[model samples]
Target: MTNTAATEIDDTSSAFTPNLTIDVGGAPMLYRRTGRSSHTVPPLVLLQHFRGNLDYWDPLLLDTLAADRDVITVDLHGVGGSGGQTPDNVSDMTRNAIAFITALGLTEIDLLGFSLGGHIAQEIALVRPRLLRRLVLAGTAPQGAPDLHRWSEDVYRWATGDVTAPEDFISLFFSGSDDGRQRAWEYLARTHTRQQDRDPESSLACRDAQFQALMTWGIPESAKLQRLSAITQPTLVANGDNDTMMYTKNSQLLAENIGGAQLRIYPDAGHGFLDQYPVQFGQHVRQFLGC
Candidate 1:
């Protein structure tokens, strides 16, 4: 008698889906899950840039990737709706991420990290080894890259400012070209489509802690590049040709040291190139992820 009761599937493929929460280590961790589930492809977990909350992602990019497979984005401890003190070091951040993943009951998955999140992804891969099936690092650098311990003067003006305006975001993420600015505007529009239940802005404590962690991670130790050999998962390293925030060369360095890692550089773009070329980059990611 109950065989024909509501056969339609629940479609959570939209980035505007309401935020969900789960307890991780006695604290609530906020996250969003999108797209359809696949038996062969693991859910793609995303980590955002410094000072970015779960709502910072471009919805167009998320939906594009979600069309084929599941996508998950988390607020990480103390960063948004998630509860806990923000960690001051990448090691502690990685531990928090691991705890979140474990609480999700996931054994293997894919990871995509942007900027600060990319650093955490690399740490997770090295520390856990077998946890990730694939890795994607965008607009980020490896630890101990020479002269990368601090932000450049021009970059410091916008990235560390008390308030980030559209102009600041344009300067930090897109290229100076007119076309690049147009793309940035479009990407910004897409990110705002979700009108309700948005994650709160990251706190000043989170910003300061993250910056300190970056400084510590970039202490100019060359041997850290050698550590890339430990991560055996298939990796995709991508960035804009002129990423002022993390530098384009860092992406090259990541690809070079990671052994057979693929690299993609978007022309006339900057740190947020992935968002600037959302559809294209999303397709590239889907292809790389084999979704």
Candidate 2:
């Protein structure tokens, strides 16, 4: 009687799938896939922000993009289901990104990297130029300088493990204090942690690990910020005007160097505006991918 019903696979279809594995960094890479149809255009991959898990991405963005093309959202090493491999160095993260793509059998795809993930995106484009079509770098920078500003005192403390849970300090992450700030914070906090995602301590440890590695992570070519011109892919350096983590100039600099890169800045947002400005950002990405 237990075996009365014949076992069947999901031969029908799915609008979205979750937690698929790929081998990267000698660990199973856990990423989520959602799409309207699998046989259409090259897929869109959403790279999570610093110390962020894939669950925090705006569902509106995911749903809209998925309706037109396949979308992959992944957690980086030392985060979420990617096995939390503590990164001793920056190259490991880059290698992890490349490996995830290879494991997915993605030949050329659109990469949308947010905050910390943007750094990884740039690394991939630099090392394996053939693998990328268009790149979107949001609220990110190429290198880190110890002397530069930390997002906030609380953020600096958290990055150093001097504290956990930088609580309300994230208020600085948005310029929309009255309406947008409350709305963004609500979404961020609600989606910030998912039970299925990595626990807070592990995520914190991963954050600490990257902090040490990135302190000295240097892009000599991009130091003089010269060789950005050498990357042959069409790039989009998008940001919010009020992102204190890094200025809008970083976007401008990236655009200027990456041969005809398009720059877009949301006038009323901050670091994570990719979620807040999903439609505009998604449209911009659509155009870039169309190109």
**Predicted model with the maximum lDDT:** 1
* lDDT, candidate 1, 1-291, per-residue tens: 121211211234365677899998788999999888999899999999999998788777888888978889998888988888889999999999999999999999999999999999999999998899999999999999866787899888888877888889889999999888777777666666556788998888888888898889888999999999888899999999999888999999999999889999999989999978888999999999998
Which 10 residues in a row give candidate 1 its minimum summed lDDT? 1-10
lDDT of each: 0.87, 0.66
Residue-wise lDDT of candidate 2 within 202-248, one digit each (tens)? 36677777676555553333454664656788888998887766556
* TM-score between model 2 and native: 0.81
Give the clashing pairs for model 2.
Answer: 222-225
Model 2 C-alpha RMSD to native = 7.5
What are the RMSD figures for all models against the true structure? 6.7, 7.5
**What's each prediction's TM-score?**
0.94, 0.81
In Å, residue 28's CA in model 2 sits off its true spot by 1.6
